[model samples]
Target: MRLAELQGWIVNILRRGSVLAAGGLMGAALAAPQAAQANLHQRYRHVVRIHERLGGIASPAASGPLAPGIDWIVMDAATGRILSEHNAYNERFPASLTKLMTLDLAFHALSHGRLNANTPLPVSPAAASVQPVKLNLVAGQTVTVMQAMLGMTTLSANDAATALGQYLGGGSIRRVAAEMTARAHALGMERSEFRNPSGLPNPNQVTDAYDMAILARHLLLDYPQYRYLFSVPSFRFEGRTIPNIDGMLKRYNGAIGMKTGYTDLARFNLVTAAVRNGHMLIGVEMHAPSWIVAYNRMTQLLDAGFAAESGAPTTVIATATSPQPRAAMPPPPVRQPAAAPVLVASRSRTAPVHMIVARSVGHVTRDMIPGWTAQVGAYDSYILAKRQALTIRGERKVGIARVGSAVVHRHRIWRAQIAGLDHNDANLVCSAMRRAHQSCFIIPPSNESLAMR
Candidate 1:
């Protein structure tokens, strides 16, 4: 149905304000699969954006032009067709969206009889040591698989996720993360990788918005029995009822449950699913400048998704990079150049997530550009990254190094970098830093730096 065809909705559209106006283009894409409408070969595929003046003021989009690298995708649960998307394939830091895989792994364990709901996951020192935005499970405390999942989903508890990862990894967090990444690839998440179960700021951990959407679809299709885990209003843990971190469950009509996350580097990330008129749709938004903006915008997109499905019933197609073959459904249309850039008024009042932690370390290589860089910390300010570099050099009292800022997602953050060092020297620096009880990753000049927007 075209704009006039959606007669009843026109009234609602006028009443909804700029949100629906901005999000309307997506609704057109979502209008479901019509043999004549979805033209994959066209220069302009499903892109629809409106940039005209409103309320006698230039829209925020005129000034901002849609913050770079923000990715979003919506898919029909019944049909795998990706109804709408932008920057959907670009790799990004997933933040807490990583927990969906943790949930998948745990659910896999349950289904395979390798672990039962009653299985005990004792908190390791590592799990306890993870920073706050955690459940605060003390070291040696034991929690059941169910308890941990509740914490992982509702509280977005880092400790619980880490504890579960440690348990499932056979005492090796790295091993479990590798296994999760493998499973994700097998399930058709081609551009995704994982470093930690909890989505702490690790540059090695990366996934595109489309990959997350595939994961969401699998969660809905693969484990319908466990759908309650994602949408539950609240769950009890350690004698407290922890409300879900997903705000849409209460605020947005038909909002079910999904995941949410934020880090200065990952920025705010979200994956949401909702149902209306018996149709289900999932929304994935990454690298939003603010939580409020991300949530509101997603709700608007989901409304479009539901409206689209209502216009026509969806047909099954591959969602995201799924390897599954769809002989009947046609390939997705080529992206139409957007008529207007997507933009939002981000209220940056909330402090950015502090992802970097500077600590005691030991290493030295003075007055020489070594060739390779070993990064230990990340900051929102270039000055802070440089200051941390100076402090590290001052502590070592023998090495010359400098700090640089890199773009992680849309957020411009500082990296505590020591550039111009050889591989061996970088290794030795990292080895010494690790021994000094710090974390480090060697960065080569040719390395795919996460700083690039």
Candidate 2:
């Protein structure tokens, strides 16, 4: 769906936020076939009956005046600084927000080469039996891992999430939940526990806003390559276009998708990440009264964070890089003649040299030179990227290897680059750096480089 249309849809929904039940927006925006919705509700009603028999809410429906437990947090994605928080550590039902951890595990599998986008995962009877707000997969059928991820992200497909969890956990959803909890603890999400990949209600399955922030940050920084799955507006499957449930992607500028979740017990939960002028912030709202309130709270948190960061000089300062082994250093710049451009010499055989060419600082602005850029690395933090760029330039100077940091706004990452090198010089530097066992890549001049400014 287009941005304007999505914004209009959310606006219409928000206008009725007052009367909308906690889970009403979810059902309204499901986009499932009418029969599927009916069947899913019937299944949920049956579950509710079983729950009541075991002593739980008698009805699946939750009227809007949300009960007390509300936890919220906003954190600076780069620095791990807490911008604002309230009741952040209080555990509550996670609902579908639990899928973030599920995705985290899937991302780890993909990164480690154990899984791929085309890998097919089987849908078992247990997975097919998951409740509403799912992809409606048939048991014994296979869905590619990528399709399942999109289904989870866009449709919040319970069946797809369960299938993915089972596949990653060696065909045991119970095992995957344990792995998810262990992974959560490893990531410093100490307050989280996972009982199911679909975030279906389990009395023991719980998480807090603070832990959700940690999980969201991992999704953004740790599994950056697959982050696109979150922002996808929609995906086509079985000849149907399922719009992403994350209205933030379409409604808010610079909003990178995270996740949205709701269940009567969990009320409304949202984790959102947004970037502005190279600054990224993640906000979590758990147990919100309604979807509108959750989104509004997140927007306020991020807007205030960006505003504060803008007014103050960025805390994302550049840190000096630790010296690499002399053997790993690209051979020092060829000795320049006394009259030739002053070459800053290495301070010592083992010490990394840093030459501040005062006269040559602006010799090659990104706009003035039309050539490829040599990138050493892209870092989650500006400080790290700047440090790498500075260190790499000190070690190797092919042409004017002017250190520069370019913000890849789309990913909210900083690229450590030595811009202004022509294609030949770029290739030479990359080759030399590679020979020295250092990372380097030639990035051709493009609009993306313009972001360096």
Candidate 3:
């Protein structure tokens, strides 16, 4: 079967609850030993073509059942105070989020005058042949340091990132990866290891939420001047406008840019930073089941972190009218044998590195299956209702807050509710809100009033 047919067949089988069969067929058809082995060196590519065809609109989840690993954390970017976390130190694949370290090295090189933004770097055959979500860089062509970085930030281009690695490594990608890992260690990412520059599906390459959060904080703090590159929504590459894959940049109100990563093994990973009311928050999530879940949960984490930090109800609310992000669907990864653990250690630097710990706000995890909603209050405007819901959600640190409308007496009114909670969760949240003298009521799974946006 063709790639498209293979994708469709996998989806159909998965929907029918035959994950094992799909995996079996996929292994037989696509995971041939030779090809799989070759891919280990080529790395993978982003599905940029499909992403463009969809006009940057995120389609519904298409990857099979959710990938198993789930790790996340949210923290104050400036103060290093972790608001919440779960399994923050567990090792998981970092995928293309590895480019953040690559970019870190790039920024460091630029700062020390070791590399110039306009410096010409030659692309190798190795860089040109990596998988999709790429710029299709030709081996003989040369891309400037800025162009390569832009390609990485916007398209998550494997070719661009590889070429960057080769340049920084003096024509060696492995050397650059070692340097990346070394820098990560200096920044206090002890549990992480970097085997490749582009987070292709290397079994040995790994990291955790805590390590990623620390890396993100360093990127923001260490390279304030180059931070604008992360926020570049799109860039002109070879006459094509390549958009950033991190949809939160357009979907969430205060979202700045960080990075997004995925692979069959790694699932969906994201590190997001945003500024609201002058406070910057950094969030990291790993191995989310799908792209939609990854973005939604990241937004929830950031919202809750902001709400907790503000020490008051949040006034800003993200409405449905905000730009809907178009999702990119990469072709499924070929299965590979699990990799053995590889330990990585970096030489210590003189610069002091402080580790940030979670501030004990109870385990803050996404209510991935919210079966009940607690209605806080409704207001004249949708924004007001959403604001109230967000405030309550942050204050309570539970459920996904959202706004839906109702037509009452022929006049449309908005409803503010926190969804993604079960029966006991709903009751507990409502009781807490009631204790605080706030209006609180529970809407059952079948409640007509719980029309979420």
Candidate 4:
């Protein structure tokens, strides 16, 4: 063929190839969005089912007048199947029940020869300073690891926890906390995190009923030898006697002691295990309105579990099957924007207004600080700002600022910025604040802004 003929053919081929590639690209572009939408829809369904089966949303009993304020979860100890759950995954402070993980690590150390039950653990100044409900160990004093374990499990001793943490962690409390968190994750307590060895009131120290249940189950199943520690009625150590805080040990039949914890944020949490007719059940409740309420709720859970077992046919040894695996689903789609805020035209109708103040340093996260009021004001100097900031160190931040031509004084601000948080997350943060008795407001930054004079 002539050069001109060959060139014409090559151009034709190139044009056809371009057309095919463009068509393929268009097809992919069209298909991708639909696929994403479909995946999102599937995920929504999965979440709904999870909420329903897990009872993480609203409980059936919550509608009744006698509904307990505590969030309760009960599960078959053998199979790890949830038997009855109410707010099973509702997040709450773990309190001293945090020691369960601490004890778990101690046991691991024993197993690994890093430490033994009879190992002498020295109480440091840090350990002796941990707040009350303690064994009252003095700094530089020594106690066996086993004694500390008993003190922690039976008496919920903060001092003992500190000593044990120091001993097991080789003198660094931070390392112990890190190991505790890592172990919690290894045990699949996904909803839980630990910041301290003892369940002190750290805002970051938090766990949920589901996660507690998981930990309790592991303790009962994986570490049966340590089970007796939970049942001790009292511990007498260092010239002080402390009684176990778990009421179920005395009140409930077949009750096995696990752990009890309380804090303003956690509001009384308990993990109780019971064995009835060879069937073991574990119950967890967090944020109960009162200690008595927590006890009653666990009792009810145990009764229900026993009743279910009794109803099952004997000799057949029927096992509760694991719940069906739900399909893998994507998370809920991004919510559409809300309707524009209504502007009232009538004199009687007023626009809803919100006020915010800076939080202080050392103030528990908005979720943990209770009964906090914001300081409103405009400031002119960094010195004033710094002083105000120091005052609310743990509760809020103080800074110089002006809002809409108003000279605000000593305004408190949140140091942490939650940028682009979704509605659910925002609501969660708000709820946490309310639970902790702190005040919070959502503020939208202005497109145009100016520094305060």
Clash counts for the predictions, in order: 10, 0, 13, 25
lDDT of 3: 0.67
lDDT of 4: 0.59
Model 3: weakest 10-residue lDDT segment is: 351-360
N/CA/C clash count, model 3: 13
lDDT of each: 0.64, 0.64, 0.67, 0.59
Q: Please give the ranking of all candidate structures by lDDT, highest first, separated by commas.
A: 3, 2, 1, 4
Q: Best candidate per lDDT, number?
A: 3
Give me the displacement of residue 321 in model 4, in angstroms: 18
Per-residue CA lDDT of model 4 for 176-216, tens digit only, reads 88889988866666547788888987655667787788788
Error of 3 at 360 (Å): 52
lDDT of model 4 at residue 438? 56
The parts of candidate 3 lying over 4 Å away from their true place are 1-69, 313-453
**Candidate number with the higher TM-score (2 or 3):** 3
Angstrom error of the Cα, residue 35, model 2: value is 53
Give candidate 4's error at residue 28 in angstroms: 21
- Model 3 lDDT per residue over 25-64, tens place: 4544433442434333221111111222333333233332
Candidate 1 vs candidate 3: the TM-score winner is 1
Sorted on TM-score, best first, the list reads 1, 4, 3, 2
Better of 2 and 4 by TM-score: 4
* Residue 393 C-alpha lDDT in model 3: 68
Candidate 2 residue 243 Cα shift, in angstroms, is: 1.0
lDDT of 1 by residue, 1-453 (tens): 366645544443334334334443554454443224334423212221111111222223311112365678887665566677765655677989999999999988898899997899999999988854566678988999987887877667788999999888999989999999998876667558888999976655778777788888777766676776776655555544455546567558777678988766577789998877656788999988655577778987887777666674444233343333232342332121122111111212132211111222422122112135677678887666767676765454322345556565788776775544445656766787899888778766344233221
